[model samples]
Target: MDIISIIAPMILVFFGYTIGSTRIITGGNEALVERLGKYNRKLEPGLNFIVPLVEKIAIEKTTREQILDIAPQPAITKDNISVEVDAVIYWRVFDWVKAYYEVEDVEDAIGNLVITTLRSAIGRQELDETYSSRSEINKTLLEELDKATDDWGVKVLRVEVQEIKLPDSIMESLEKERAAESEKQAAIFKAEGEKQASISRAEGTVQAIEMIAQALKGQSNSKEVLKYLVAQRFVDANQKLGESNNTKIIFMNPKDVSEGVGELLEEDTHISDERIGNGSN
Candidate 1:
């Protein structure tokens, strides 16, 4: 009976000790430990021992990555274009101590920070720049969030901008502007081509005129060349008149013909007189 009485107290203490010792799961986490309402060492994963009725856990936090979605918020671009943008953030707890006490709600704090940062970023850029520079903006947002949440023991992994909504009218106007610019460029190209063709034609005509002038100068004293030129002119005139379906009678001036014949005779007489004088000498 005395052995039973003594063993009872020991059994109760053993039971209490067994209850105090715990094994946290591998994928789980815990936080600051307090013994007798005083701060003690932090509890980690695996087996942990504590004094029954004296040690208690004050705050428990999970050290796993968390996903947070930011609600859509209105943003105004530098060009006065209003848009709605939403995003998501990936974060995890880096410091368990600060994560437990430094911030009231880490998720909520991060969400608000992201909203403000995105607003500021969008406001500084135009609409096109905002859309094209999303990657840069996301990098800046992650940096800013990491710095802001450092005290809270939060590590921001990445920020993703999900959607950016612009007004229908703005989209339509942008499309029209793009099309107009393309048309203007096409017109400029066409005008340039025409200008080049005209220049080439003018150059060719100038060269032809120079060659003709050279030939005329070389044969200035040839009556046969003059007759050939006159005959070609007459043929071209007749062809043009025939194409016009007009039967027009053309007459030559007798006086002009007589004058040309008289000049030829005078040239021959001069040549013969020169030959006779040489012979007499």
Candidate 2:
């Protein structure tokens, strides 16, 4: 029994040592092995055997995509407008050794770097530009971050500007300015329309006058045409006076009316009575 007890302890110890030496790493993950507190080699995913007491696993890093959510940060624009901006970052570790050793905290480092880059980018643009040029700003930020984090064994896949908060006063003022501009444009358009209408009316009046003059010149005797035109004008005037309900009647002597009619008829005569009378005299 004493011999069996000693052999059982030895067997358990051997099994424990073997179990500790063997490591099963899953896919997309890498383990860094260190010998005597010094980096010895990188272990790929699978069953790997290491000297249990002499070799230690330094760090384990995953190669899968990682998402980092950045909190809202205060930024100043080129026009000195203060704003709060937030974003998200997509990244992955390319080299396990460098990722573990180059930076103390990878997540925090990336967060801070993003904040700084966003602030700097925002500072270079005005509030209007910042709102309009989000895509450009995001591309620049990704490129800068990728360059900065390359040494840390991280690859930035994408950077996105999620939200931007602006001051209420600026927004209100912009709206008012836009409204005023629209009103001014409308006024200018109205004035142009009036000017065009006036020009058209003047052109039409000139054309009408030219047409009337041509008609008069085409007549064989303008005197008959003038007599007919004067008669039409008198008829139109009489019709207008009759249509007015408030018109008042005026009394006239029969002799005066007869004399006026006789004068009108004599004035319309084609032959000159003055020449005939002079000949007689």
Question: Which candidate number has the best TM-score?
Answer: 2
Q: Residue-wise lDDT of candidate 1 within 82-145, one digit each (tens)? A: 9999999999987877876777877777888889998998898898898899998899888888
What TM-score would each prediction reach against the true structure? Answer: 0.59, 0.62
lDDT of each: 0.76, 0.81
Poorest 10 consecutive residues of model 1 by lDDT? 209-218
Give the clashing pairs for model 2.
Answer: none
lDDT by residue (175-243, candidate 2, tens digit) is 999999999999899768766865786587456534543455435664355444545544544565576
Candidate 1 positional error at 23, Å = 4.4
Worst 10 residues of 2 by lDDT: 249-258
